[model samples]
Target: MNNGWFYTAEFRDGRFTQIQWQRSGQPPQTTTLTFSSTNGQGQPIYTGAFQAATAVTLVDLSGGNVQPGSQVSVEVEEWGWARGNCRR
Candidate 1:
């Protein structure tokens, strides 16, 4: 089977957030995933909730403000399989 995933990030109100991951066609039966964020120091910052859906939204709560040239990145991964991995 061909597994696929998508992710996106956005900044609003000086906070970093994710829009959601939309599946290509249909949703998965057993969808298990996790979300996390960190700072430039590679420290664990924020962790998001998991759900069963084609997409998910993430939020960064590092208590830092996001500027226009702020260097922020996000990562998404799929559990039990090594297919869905995103960074931005």
Candidate 2:
């Protein structure tokens, strides 16, 4: 079943980045974060920030899944920043 767990990061500078649905109870995985802008038509314009940016780390915590009573938490951290198209 899809746990529908996702990680999202919003920069104070107005950037929204989201990671795909990740399964719980699994080892941590490295995912790339990205930013984009909107065109005049109001469509998302994506750009690659793999070079200038650092890596994003995601951690899964055991919760509600182990014992009868428990909780799960997701952690996220930003490695670095990338310069290019700003978020709109």
Candidate 3:
């Protein structure tokens, strides 16, 4: 069983790259973490929601089509676990 107290995740071009976390009461840390390397490709529908996510596919919202440097940043608010995307 793999486990860690993860607080944040980072990605580059749709690839799972790193995580910010802490091990119990220890100091929080930012460390390299990758649970997948397939670029999150494959079937879209996942039958299991409670199960850990095996993949994530990032897309380009640039209208033309998904291409290099086309990914955009999305701001999410977890305050009270209920909020919408906050764009500036």
Candidate 3, residue 30: the lDDT equals 49
Note the clash tally of each candidate: 1, 3, 0
Superposed model 3: Cα runs more than 4 Å off: 1-4, 34-88
TM-score per candidate, chains pooled: 0.39, 0.29, 0.30
State the lDDT of candidate 3 residue by residue for 18-81, as single tens digits: 4444468767754444332222433111111111333222222333233445433221122111
The digit string of per-residue lDDT tens for model 1 on 6-46 reads: 44444445444434445678563322323355557543343
Top candidate, metric TM-score: 1
Ranking by TM-score: 1, 3, 2
| Model 1 clashing-pair count | 1
The models' CA-based lDDT, in order, is 0.39, 0.32, 0.32
Decoy 2 TM-score against native: 0.29
**By TM-score, how accurate is candidate 1?**
0.39
- Candidate 3: 10-residue stretch with minimal lDDT: 42-51
- Residue range with the least summed lDDT across 10 consecutive positions in model 2: 59-68
Candidate 3 achieves a global lDDT of: 0.32
Tens digits of lDDT, candidate 2, 1-88: 1233333322234333443333477643333545344446443333333223533332212211222222222233242322222122
